[model samples]
Target: MVDPDDVQFIDEMPHTATGKIQKTALRDMFADYAFPA
Candidate 1:
């Protein structure tokens, strides 16, 4: 199982024009994301 602290929730997910997940965008958006203690 994945550690709870390693999880995150968001109101929306970044996507491409074609509706495919934009990994690059996600990375940039969460570039400063920090996991919980």
Candidate 2:
């Protein structure tokens, strides 16, 4: 099951110069996220 608390709603995803979603950059940005207990 998915946890709502763990979901992050961004205005828009990060993109590269070529206009492709930067998965690595996105992951790095949220790599330290901590879910509430």
Q: Which has the greatest lDDT?
A: 2
- Model 1 has an lDDT value of 0.83
Residue by residue across 8-34, what tens digits does model 1's lDDT show?
A: 678899888899998898899889997
Question: Candidate 2 at 23: error in angstroms?
Answer: 0.5
TM-scores for every candidate against the unseen true structure = 0.63, 0.61
In angstroms, give how far residue 9 of model 1 lies from its true place. 0.4
Lowest summed lDDT window (length 10), candidate 2: 2-11
Give me the candidate number with maximum TM-score. 1
Steric clash pairs (candidate 1)? none
CA lDDT of each prediction against the hidden true structure: 0.83, 0.88
lDDT of 2: 0.88
Q: How many clashing pairs does model 2 include? A: 0
